[model samples]
Target: MTEQVSAASNAAVDTISRAGWGAELRATFALAWPLVIAQLAQNALHTTDVIMLGRLGPAYLAAGTLATTFLNAFLLGSIGVVGAVAPLVAQARGARDIKAVRRVVRQGCWAAIIISVVMIPLLLQIKPIYLALGQDPLATDMAEQFIQIAAWSMFPALGIIAFRSFLSAYDATRAILVITVLGVLINALIAYTLIFGHFGFPRLELRGAAIATLTTNFIMLGMMVAYVLRHRRLKRFNVLVRFWKPDWPRLREIFRIGLPIGLTVLAEVGLFTAAALLMGRLGTDEVAAHAVALQLASMAFMVPLGLGVAATVRVGIAFGRGDIDGVGNAGWTAFVLGLGFMAVSCTLFLTAGTFLVSLFLDMNEPTNANAIGLAITFLMVAGIFQLVDGAQVVAAHSLRGLSDTKVPMLVAIVGYWAVGLPISYVLGFVFNWRGVGIWLGLAAGLAAVAVVLVARFAMRERLGLMRSRA
Candidate 1:
């Protein structure tokens, strides 16, 4: 009788395992698709902005592009802090610690508020930096006009990111998608109106675009807050609890995990920002080509980037359950999927690079020829790095699942500064390979990160750090 019961129990466990796998697959897709579309829409906004400004002239295009890129570097770290809340909330959900989850959400929101206040001065200085880099005076002025007006939106933008992270953690992932779609439409309509002086709106040019984007972001924030408050499951947990007092220990813990991640991200942004500055020394055409390539790269990266984000939730949940095998499986699954997608992306870029470049370039003009050619060349180097780029991002999130941030930061510092930037400088200046040298340096840095992060994730899993759900 006991033997028969044991056999039945084993059968039940097998059934549960299969069911769990199915559920994870469903959840992964559900989480990934909306986020993926949202990312694409965000990229579309930049592309649309560029296209509209390009119609105005190359100088307008260059100015707007540079301003937005600088803003991303400055304000983006706040999103990294929001990221710290994801794993914490996921783990809290797994542990059924509703109080802890509520605390994390509120603290993350406050952290974003503080970051926005601190970032304002830095935002105002962007124009000076462009001038110091020797951009055309008119172009620099236009860029400054856009960036300064756009900086006002950082408060809501940063705060919304925290809210989004918390919502995703609580499995209210659909809210962000709905919000993003609405925001995208608003951006388009407002930009159209303001940029062209349509329907009684002021013809503010580049600054108009900035104002539209800012308004859309606030709208998105409002939509998300409303969703969370109305969410039944979230309401049951009282996830919206207002803290009469801040929780110091929990907030400190968040900063401890989040700050390093933010710095690591900032270091990478610094590398590219510095590269853009150095490219200015090369010439305006070089800067234009570099910006074009970077923007295209950012667009292509959205797919794998979304996949890595989904992997985080999967890994976080598995870790909370202490499922070592599950951690390995989830990490590898994301890695494989990301690599496959990047492989396709690399092929597409290699085959259609010049064609893609033409879409963003005013190729009808003889003056635009040099920039277009250089952009095509950059695509080759970018293609080489996509797989490595995908791998590193996936591995990084997998490691985050294990709650390992410090070592990842150390690795980023060495990979980006010790190796990438110096090699890029040598190649671009010393070897005179120009942009190719810079790209090769980027490839090398990403490869180092990919290898190190993968090993780290594996080591943590092997040590039984992040375990299975069942």
Candidate 2:
């Protein structure tokens, strides 16, 4: 069965390699739309939490935002590490090495467990970290309460990422979409019931929200695991059988490729986390407003992120087959698509920023006017950087498909930490621009990274990025 699937995948790659731009565009879109929708649905879970917490008042929203920002930095970084499974699996399938695919998938699950063990303890220490950063004491306490439970979700959440990556490499993404959408609905319901004490539930507030997130993660992980076990094509791999067994070299390979990717993600997410901390120092309202604006930008980012993942699978397959032109076609097509969508979103942010930010707050509340106004201002800055944000992510993922990660990781660190973070600090503090200045710094950092990553992709051959792959 594995052999048959490999033959079919290899033949499909041959067809795609020979196809024209139009076909490539269609193929990429077909692979991308479900992923895009899944990403949106996944984000909606957090959006729902923010929206509800906002109703509890600005203080609650600010606290929740701080906690989630901290959690997501670690979450996304861990996911980036486990996500190496996608390209590894894609390359294996392209070369029709079914056994290798199984090994990668198995090791990906192992990687998830290892990351959870290391990260969960670190996440539990949010209070100390927040205090050291000089966050508001009350807000820090609230945030710690939220993270205590939410931290446990890291286990199932990382597991879900591993399985999702495996499914994506196979282009079996609709299941991911279905599972995530359902998770969003479930999370919303559970959060509402627990937060507000509806339906005889205790009003747990932030803790309730944390419980909802943890429960949802476990459910999503279970669904993904069951699907892999039952699906005709995936079941043959037995990804979970003898889960405790170790494949030392394969495990090392995942860490080797995944660690840099993880750091790259941390560099970018850490920039946002630092911005949140900056906002926390300025005031609760600034933190709340920043959260709203950032949420909107993150939601819009789902499109490019999905396209980036698609590009990884497509380019990985091409690289594995040694089809040089196919790699170029896959990367560029996704790049163009990402840029075009971001242009539209940029326009939306510029034209309707007020309306978008309003959706998260109560329009009737006079107290919300200040936070809403600040959020609109941040949204405008977010709009300005949309294109570059889209470009950097897509280009970086395309490089990952060719198993080129270390350079991009360095690019991210220099771009986000060295360039972006300093600009944010200078403009926001030294220049006294406040929230707007801080946002501009973010824009500057994204632009710098985007230009570098795009140029690197353009010069892939000249840079010898593909030399070792074949």
Listed in order, each prediction's TM-score against the native is 0.91, 0.96
Model 1 scores a TM of: 0.91
- Each candidate's lDDT (Cα)? 0.77, 0.91
Best by lDDT: 2
Candidate 2's TM-score: 0.96
Task: Indicate which candidate wins on TM-score.
Answer: 2
What is the C-alpha local distance difference test score of candidate 2? 0.91
Which parts of model 1 have CA positions greater than 4 angstroms off?
1-23, 130-138, 462-470
Model 1, 1-470: lDDT tens per residue?
34433543353244335535555656677877777777777677677777677666667777777788788888766677667888888777767788888888888877777788888888999877778767667767777899888998888887787777777776666677778877878888888888879999778889889988888888888888787778787666555576456888888878888888788787778778777766767777787788788888888888877777777877777778766556656666677677888999899888899888888887898888898899999988899899889988887877776677888889988988888899999999999998889888888888777777766665563444544343
